[model samples]
Target: MEFSELLEQAGGAGLFQTLLLLTFILPCFMISFHVLLENFSASVPGHRCWTQLLDNGSVVPANITPEALLTISIPPGPNWEPDQCRRFRQPQWQLVDPNATTSSWNEADTEPCVDGWVYDRSTFTSTIVMKWDLVCSSQGLKPLSQSIFMSGILVGSFIWGLLSHRLGRKPMLSWSCLQTAVAGTGTTFAPTLLIYCGLRFVTAFGIAGIFLSALGLMVEWTTTSRRAVTLTVLACSSSAGQAALGGVAFALRDWQTLQLAVSVPFFAIFLISWWLPESARWLIIKGKPDQALQELRKVARINGHKEAKNLTIEVLMSSMEEEVASAKEPQSGLDLFRVPMLRKRSCPALVTSFSLLISLYGLVFDLQSLGRDIFLLQVLFGAMDILGRATTVLLLSFLGRRTILAGFQVMAGLCILANTLVPPDLQTLRVVLAVLGKGCFGISLTCLTIYRAELFPTTVRLVVLFFLPETRGLPLPDTVQDLESQKSTAAQGNRQEAVAVESTWF
Candidate 1:
């Protein structure tokens, strides 16, 4: 079926159904990709199939007289350094006898080799050892490849943000998905580390852009009342994706095979672009009133509302006008500081964004790289993240944004402090503290994302969100502004109420 028809069917079903499909499928794709990036063994260097063979080699058996012990010293060749010479002798020596004969040698020898050697059909046993220098040098490439991919994300975020604003969210999202598919597929065919890293960077750029645009489209399509729920659910897709990585990583254990596994999803999701509709908000903004009306009617029909056709351009324009008036102020970036209300809101949101990011991304990447059994850590952090999102959804009605945010910050800080202070000898307590810290950090991050979106006016929202200056006082371009705008808006309503109360009493 045509892509549009599939999307229409999916959208026509219900919000719950659409969310279920995306929640399930998108994360599966994402987790597979993440596993390939962070956990896939092929990305590690000096990991040729030969390494496994060497590790499985067994020592050849020898027949010696009862009083005679055969000892052969294998001299180091010209190519072997002192370090290389030592490894051949370091492995535990093993003796194998098909005849079941007994011999008087150390348990390290004469006994049937319990471990450390493999026997092939040729009756030869080999012991394999790796050259440490070669292994380290080969492993180093993986990090460089990952760094390239991250750099692409950093660049792609800005480019995609701009494109979504200029070209409309739907087109950008569709094109980005296609790019991701192509780049991802190409990655599986990379014959060299340089080629693999380059393709990965390209793939990352497309993936990053697709996510940014898709998120913006989803947010813009929903009503104000449902916005938080929709956004939170969408954000949860990322976590779900991380969870799926465990399975995908397990299935595609080899490096090249893993890359192929990762690429397949992007190709599948590309087909989704056909089914997805253009954003109703962007349609109205671009003066495509008829198309906007048609899309809105479809949503209304799915929602079982009778007023779908009645949602006129006039109503949309009025809403836009109100938003514009509310956001109207001096245009310069410095104007954010001129208003005390804006300043207060912006500062906390910005601080929370950076701090929460430091905790979340830093820990996640660190744990993944450590290559340890991190399931417990994952579950702990994942639960905390879900709980934090749920708390934001519930408490948004009762708690002021600033209060909730401040609480989150304090909780996170305490958890992190406990994580550092807990005695290392108390491994269980340390793990518990780490989980609490992760959970606290998760909630803080959710608060920041939700609060930021509510902070800015629609017209300048994207610009302010992506262009805001860093805590170090370094000014980024327009992209940071969009991120900053959300922070400012989240605190605006509370700050305004405080201002009004002060004015009445004064």
Candidate 2:
């Protein structure tokens, strides 16, 4: 019997399963927390070049106020304050006194700041930008750090996917959680930008592992009836974490403090993760049915199944062997891409993910530039994200997967186009349209995950989905022809939503 059948026989959806779901969802929430926190923690605030106000590059008279000295010593821009990177070569001391009328300040010849910039620190006292003086010549470092963290996630997905198969899910998850706790919390203490970036990358790998293992365990334990609903709800739960991250960031404006707050939770979660059960199906597939049966009996006892005590390993092994036998021997990882249909779907999915991530993050991380209040806007972002996913789930109940995915994608595209065409002066309109576009992107992505799963359960072995329960049941295809033959019924009892965010946070 399939594990789903076993779960059904043992009482499919009940208190035991509910607790298991909640346990796994904790890691999922933390994963989302890591994804969105990068925005606030790395934010660069308003700044201008710090300069000495004098004919030579020497300090101005002590009587001068910072703003008055800046008026004479910095080159002004038509909008927003003085030039961010440049300052006047010589001081116009008249501007320092309130009684003197400043004249021809725009004509002063300017040079780049010889010293570092003075930051507007009211909102953020410490951030990635300030920590390393990542402005002007070094501005790329901030975004580069973001990309490096993402690269670590992608690398971790492939590496940990293999390790999970070798070391088993539970051990790898525990170790990864330890890695996250240590590396993530250690990031706050990093003395240099290089060290901090490295720690961030390490933290991402741990986040990826928690994401994969927790998701794998939950789906494996549930029956088919609960699996689809479970996946959808699990995804929405991440939005809750994103929302909470905004609140946390709002409360603790210091980047180091925020980093410590988010990072410490992983260590606590690692302690709690001991309560998670190992996947019995994974044990059986790995030719350890005796161990699988032992775990299953524990689950059975939790569900109040008395016969579970009488169940023997040999009986369970015999049942599992039949299903394993019908499937072709597990093919190479290349098999996921070898088939024509799989490649066709896989290519666009990657392109869509890359483009979607760029657009989504670009918009979100630049949110401070928008005229809206940053804190409220972040809260709005979380609310919109939750609403978007919830709307997708609601629509799925009524519309065909393809129709819904196509419709949402098209609408998202249109919203982006509209936002692009809006005139520059209308900041309010721009913010409104930007939020609308982001909301559409959120919904489209949420639907794409559901659509892809329902569309081709056998094709996508994306790293995030590698440990997914749905992948477990797909009888490995021996040839491209085998994939074409099975495509018809491939949708049966399959459901996983865009966990690609775990790595797409690749």
Candidate 2, poorest ten consecutive residues by summed lDDT = 497-506
RMSD of each: 10.9, 5.9
TM-score of each: 0.66, 0.84
Give the best candidate by TM-score: 2
The digit string of per-residue lDDT tens for model 1 on 1-506 reads 01122223224335633543463347333732543355333322212221121343354234443112112111123443112112223322232233323242333322221222221212111101121222333446545666788788778877887777668877887787778778877876766667767887888888777767776666555434445555566555555555555555555445456566667676666676666667665565555657866776676565565644446657555544423333343344444465564565566556667777666665665544333344445545566666665656566555555666677767877866776776656666766666666666655565566556555434334432223322111111122243355346444532331211011110
Candidate 1, 321: how far from true, in Å?
4.5
What are the clash counts of all predictions, listed in order? 33, 1
What lDDT is reached at residue 172 by model 2? 81
What's model 2's TM-score? 0.84
